[model samples]
Target: KKKKKKKTMEMSLNLASSSTSNSVFLFNPILSGKQLAFPCRHQRIPKRVKPFCVKSSINLSGPRQTLSSNWDVSSFSVESLSQSSSRLPSFEELDITNMLLRQRIVFLGSQVDDMTADLVISQLLLLDAEDSERDITLFINSPGGSITAGMGIYDAMKQCKADVSTVCLGLAASMGAFLLASGSKGKRYCMPNSKVMIHQPLGTAGGKAMEMGIRIREMMYHKIKLNKIFSRITGKPESQIEGDTDRDNFLNPWEAKEYGLIDAVIDDGKPGLIAPIGDGSPPPKTKVWDLWKVEGTKKDNKNLPTEQSMIQNGYAAPE
Candidate 1:
């Protein structure tokens, strides 16, 4: 190879051209595993710095995770790509946004699987522990999934010290609707166009006759539990809830409010009914939630020791 002079190559380069053209020239000759250095007029700039390249692994774990990696290059223009990459959030901005969201907001926009349940419950518990007096907002827009997972979230919301304000954005269906109704009373709201749907727990059982029988029994138990929840929240009869949920029962915002599923239809700027505080009245308290405690089931305390029996033993309390 002939050795080229630095002065000859410097004159051929155009300073007025776009930075992308300069980048192309910088990498073209280096593909053959050889160092190609070019001289520039600016002495203040550092010389012979190689471009940094990053290698990333493709994740194929889930639909959501996989979809983020597969981008259509033909859909985006080069200018849009350049602008998007240049305008990424700084570390400080990202940290601030994350902190704000964790402190006050719990958004549920996807199907409520075990992972979603865990994340929402953990955030609610942590926020309640941090500042019990402050209210936490939960925005839900889910088509519903996993009755067991949704029940976990419902229990967590009841156990938390902070009052959760549930808001419906697009649609809250099935388990999602149940969670919305489980929020602190007088704090539930749905948008003007949002839809709320309720129905019986759905599942597909596959196996022998015994296994199918067990699955049917379990599903019936969940349906009964959910019906009781709706009855309690909406102040309706359990029979009425059962009849309505026999099929898909979708309600508009006005219909939801009329059915007592939500307190108000959010039309103005007010985010549902405000909780009354500092009016010489006792603050509202939360009940201890027991997921397995179905109604009409009596606890057998016959085996438990009474106070009289405790006195005969050494476990008596002294005055």
Candidate 2:
């Protein structure tokens, strides 16, 4: 019963150019460090005085690589800033004419019953009825909450008329990660430091532990329900999901991908966040996902995708 320690970092930046402005958002993991370190936060430089580049640099100890962002004058959005937070994702949708065709989208964020899904659904409705389409990348960063809620959101994603891609940021553990993976039309992805965990669901009943028999039955029920969710995503057996859940260790990005959980490796393209605790938390982490996938499907318990296969496919090399 070992656990993998995980760190998730979130960041945001506002950029201005004439009448239009844009915000870049990201959530990345410091999953590649020996000592669990993070980079320094950068100041928001004034747009006029700022160089053409909105440069941010980060250095981490051990296997973690240095991450930097230096944007060019050419890379930017032309949309005006007279917008609402609700309107932000709408910018990602596109317009296609002479067809009722819709684009793919995988909307991720908070767990079900969370406001994240509501906004996503409404946005999709607008895109659908208004004669436009979009495929989406749902960038997810959540610790997980509410099992039924998560499944409800997943169903919504399936019902969406377009393609959906879910990019895991930070921790996609528990139901949060579960729903995130469910969004992919083809497959799921994770950042280098991303972590995914699944275990039997748990609950604290007001009834005393003295009612041990009933509680035992209830726990078993939860186990079955959780196993079903895992089975749907990975094509793995419920028994396997139970085994992994009971073991209590977290799976790093590579392990997750190998297990048929994540499809590829992607950088959320953001910095790790450091709180005042002075541990390995800082800012200046801006990252984005560019998908790279290996071909071939799963067989037995092995993962094979190339003419040259992996030396060891399941675990990330230790930091």
Candidate 3:
């Protein structure tokens, strides 16, 4: 019965190809049965078998076109086909925000969950790898989420050799504010009306008494670490950061600058950090904070600070 079935399958394949030179053969006959057997007597038929597809191009009315003898069946695999389709997808049609990524800009507009943080971290790393001397602009408007995830992104930013310039759009709270402060010094900026809020890490403890206690301790450690990070970024005393972050400290752009959370408040007439390519002016110089070397890492060269007279305060130095 097996011999008859194999003969029938071979005849069918032969007839299929012989019917028309243009007809494409689209399947392998050997693996058509319930199980695939090998010629070796010791080899047994596997319980499962992978399907294969074979194709032959047909010439319709036009001139004959033949595939190269070097054509590889592996190239027509389902996985390869899917990957090719994915590569051809339109970014705009897919609604992927690749335009900013192309410009070395990463937007943290959503909560800093694992997915969001991973994407931002990857973009930062990729952009840095592309051009270590170029600045990576990070636009942030997030309420924040996941301290661990945010820390991962923060570490990635610091790990990059390129500088990161953070911009605050609408609001930056919790871990968002931490990231805003993590940008290269003298390069951080906030929209004129934007706000920044810094506070101790918030969390809920559950499960068991021991688990609750452990979680609380971990939160405390994170708070201390955050305070140190802010102190280092803002050039403020750790005590000040601790007190300020004890509760929700909301600061407007100017107040944020005063609090050392940002370097400047962007307004009209401000050149800001968005410089067109091929512009005669050189790219702004920035300082990258190295996680390994925390002290004396400030850059002496910085672009001229854009001045805006403070209405509330009589006179304030360039922030």
Candidate 4:
């Protein structure tokens, strides 16, 4: 009976030792003061102990067993770095590139405000400083804004060492007209359908009667100065200029040419003396007016009255 009891005790001790070798112990420093144990093999884990199995495989080859966790830190870092490297350049970078390439094409397609004037002046100065002999072209398509801004650009154009050739693409009105007229003689140009408008300086006066009167006198002086400028540019009598500028006067390309406001109207086939900037092709021959013509209408409307219409309409005919 004693031998049989001793043999049973030895078998029980062997089973306990095998279980302890296969089991993994984990210590939860944060959750519990005691150590929790789990089976190391792939088997049905107890429902209460499922959360403790962070890793499915264990390396038992070394004295220190290593758990194969799901976190692959090296691969994650590589993916993050690749994503950052593939991003496109921002708008500021594109703007810088455009500014560098668009040095020769000076676009005045907005209101001639202080900002516009400053930009135009700086571009003109840069162009002149780069190559004084190279002719710089100024494209004016403004409805016209601050007279002060216009004067600033006008003075810069006049003072620049480069010969500025102005082209009117669409509407050149008020101060815009002044800019067009300021271009180098024989180089001033206008698109066939573009319009040019001129008028006296306009403003609103406020404050005391004395202040208002002073402002009026100042305006009159500017008006006279503008009249002289117009007379000089158009080769017209100051009286005629004053009468024409009493209200807004709009002129077609042909009328502008006759009035000495523009040297010539652009012909697509013949760009005349105007030279292209850099490697840019010459302006296309298709005039805006031609695009708007009726499909079957006469190509040349000879019935249209000539400059004689100016005299008949009570305006001085161009000489």
Candidate 5:
């Protein structure tokens, strides 16, 4: 009689394990075209003083094993791809969105530069609706960016159906930092390594000093508009908002919490139910401009912002 080959069942488990040094481990898999889109799932992570794993893997090959424990696993996830079907489910429909129970909040990081408003919106759209009901955490790590762009983000975060708790990772400076302080309703927090800043919008222009002087005047007017938004969210007075954003203030994580910038300093995951900031209000008004502003450039009257539904704001795309 031939000895039968031993059979074994295969399954992957995701555990939230942390180290005394604040090291974390995270593993997940994405399927594509009946194949793993990126076979090498191990992603090179940014080196932090605390060793932490992420959605991908990290390098543990240093001669000096700085980390107390090296986590390695072969089985991650085995998902099947459905082919032969006439049509398929779009990633937008099947993605993870509101995983409140899972404590898996999606942080768009900061749109300081390349991280544009559109990119963050698209990412949120990919989240599955089921996850929307779950507590959605935003792990913000940014130093603020465009004034107008930040407001666009503020509108998005302020209107989340999911429970959003923002935890600052690095520096939430300028417009980026202020938005977080105001946008989070229930649990606003920061890491020990985080910092916050509020200042006037600064930009470079191509013009003469005389023209530059006029530009500064226009920018200052817009400065008040930004201040109002920050003050409304932070519950601060316009007087205080203007003074802080006037290049006269910089706040570390400690100063941020003291000044109502953040709610708490959480070392790890927070467990509880948090009400959403607010429901979806009426659509924002469009900012129409003189077509003549662009020399001979025609405007698409049909594709105006007023016509576009709030769904197109990058939250969830219409099927």
Candidate 6:
């Protein structure tokens, strides 16, 4: 009996040692007593770890949600941009009033096209309506263009209430010379260095021979009319005017004055007096006030001689 009891005790001790060899023990300084632990082949526990948690209001029964009282977003808009741009001035705001006022000078410096002729006519009529008694000056610096256009302007000048004074600044050729010659008798003037040219009217015709012949006839008629006008103005014979205008006849200011195309050659030294030509004799030294001096005396000023007084004084009208 004693031997069997001893054998049972030995077997119990061996089982306890085998279980201890299969188990693991972890030493945790935080724990007061030793805790039993199991060894895991596939899982591990980290030495330091932090807990993750979400906070909430005291009420926990209702659904969790968030609400924002204020929110702002910025973006570009076309209306706002247009309103900002409208504050700037446009191209049409440019002022031309001062320029027009300073230079009462009318410019005929381009080709004598229909548009140019119309503009000149309208401007002259406006000036005439503005002040009929004041002189209107027309400055010509053209190489000449449409004869019909030039004639339109010329006729308007003759009919306008104001006296039209034509001044040639540069080359007054072809139709330009015609207009220059048609200025108010004593008002036609040319700069000393300008050139004047006159030539027969020109035209281009095509189609049937009859059509071309008709055009030729029309051109001849115009030529005849122009000869008459020139003769009347320059006191030259029609034949002479025809011969001179047969081809391009270019003349300097002095020659223009000699040909009666212009009444005077503007002298830089004498502002308003007519400059003399190459002839030995001096030109008539007339003053602007000479024409009005008699009228001025007629007002009983006695400061000058009246036209009647001049007549009584044997001073005949200047030749």
Most accurate candidate by lDDT? 3
List, residue by residue over 133-222, the lDDT tens digit for candidate 2.
445456678777766566666676677665566777888878776765686545466777677876667666556655865877876786
In the order shown, the candidates' Cα RMSDs to the true structure are 20.1, 31.9, 19.8, 20.9, 28.9, 31.0
Query: What lDDT is obtained when candidate 2 is compared to the true structure?
Result: 0.55
TM-score for each candidate, following the candidate numbering: 0.56, 0.46, 0.58, 0.56, 0.48, 0.55
lDDT for 172 in candidate 1 is 99
Error of 4 at 305 (Å): 32
The model with the greater lDDT, 2 or 4, is 4
- Candidate 4: list runs displaced more than 4 Å: 1-103, 268-319
Query: For residues 244-309, what per-residue lDDT tens digits would candidate 3 score against the true structure?
Result: 786677787777877888887666334577542332221233455233223432221123232453
RMSD of 5: 28.9
Model 5 C-alpha lDDT per residue in residues 121-159, reported as the tens digit of each score:
544443424455655566677777776676666666656
Order the candidate numbers by lDDT, best to worst: 3, 1, 4, 6, 5, 2
Whole-model lDDT values for every prediction:
0.76, 0.55, 0.77, 0.75, 0.57, 0.74
Tens-digit lDDT track for model 6 on 83-150?
A: 78754433332223223322344678889999999988887877777667777788899989997898
Q: Residue 25 deviation, candidate 2, in Å?
A: 71
Candidate that scores best on TM-score: 3
* Higher-lDDT candidate of 2 and 5: 5
Weakest 10 consecutive residues of candidate 1 by summed lDDT: 276-285
Q: Candidate 1: where is the Cα deviation over 4 Å?
A: 1-92, 95-103, 268-319
Off by over 4 Å in 6: 1-103, 268-319
